[model samples]
Target: MIKELVAGVVATTWKRLHGPAQWRILWLKHATFMIGVTGVVLDDHDRVLLLKHRFWKDCPWGTPSGYIERGETIEAGFAREVAEETGLTVGQVAIHKINSGFRLRMEVSVIGRLIGAAEPQVDGVEVTEARFFRRDELPDGLRASQREVILAAGATS
Candidate 1:
């Protein structure tokens, strides 16, 4: 039901944007909608991987995440984000949930398995620190939504 509603809204908006010259201007003005992806990776010890983002000051520790690039599948994008942020290769990702933001941003969360026994490392730019933590030992300042996603992912796994 919710998916259909969202699809209908997007389709209607796209169709409405194809009208006259004034409406074309409206379309040009509304740019930069983003689809983001998050991965919940658990090690053999049931520890979850998290990255301390260098950019997000208030909420630093959260699931590895980034924007989905054009022409990239959501699972591929999630794998890319995890690798770029933590240097950990993803095995298989199972999508768990999707949440839309108040603005034009949408986030898809997934539970992913790591490929090998690689340790976490930072990219030194987007992510400053990467580490695995037990659920009770998760660090402070995680985003509320991301915390929920992590819990959901853990539950599914």
Candidate 2:
């Protein structure tokens, strides 16, 4: 209790010294958490795109996903992750869900349509394979939560 009170006093004094604008910036830096993006990329046939990441152990086959780069909007980051991992462009991007990314990270899930005729070609290093699977016949090893997200995206269109 004494430590908490002392810390509170120090924070209040620091806030007053910095003024509101600087205090807000300092508070945001201390409070904001990491955000990541995942996508349920859909093709013309309504198949959902999935990738086999070389690094994942428990679940190697999953949706195209990555952390947001600095100055990137969630949509832009999602598109970049897809393209970087699978060599496929995505359009019609729309946020489908926002949920816990993992331990303490925040996730933004999006639904996007495949923009071109080119099929998915994995990066070969980070991602060993990329393929689109029919919604009715998704592959094994995909996280159940991701399967639900993909199904939910299919339900909308």
Cα lDDT computed for each candidate against the true fold: 0.83, 0.87
Cα error of candidate 1 at position 132, Å: 0.4
lDDT of prediction 2? 0.87
For candidate 2, the TM-score is 0.80
Tally clashes: model 2.
Answer: 0
Candidate 2: give the clashing pairs. none
lDDT of 2 by residue, 51-148 (tens): 98899999999999999987898999999999998889999899988997366689888899999899788769999999889877787888876887
Model 2 stretches with alpha carbons more than 4 Å out? 1-20, 27-29, 101-103
Stretches of candidate 1 exceeding 4 Å from the true structure: 1-32
Q: How many collisions per candidate? A: 0, 0
Candidate 1, residue 42: lDDT: 84
What TM-score number comes out for model 1? 0.76
Candidate topping TM-score:
2
**Model 1 lDDT per residue over 1-157, tens place:** 9999999998887776646855667768876678988878988876899888888878888888889998898999999888877788997788888887548888888888888999988768888888889899988888887788778867767
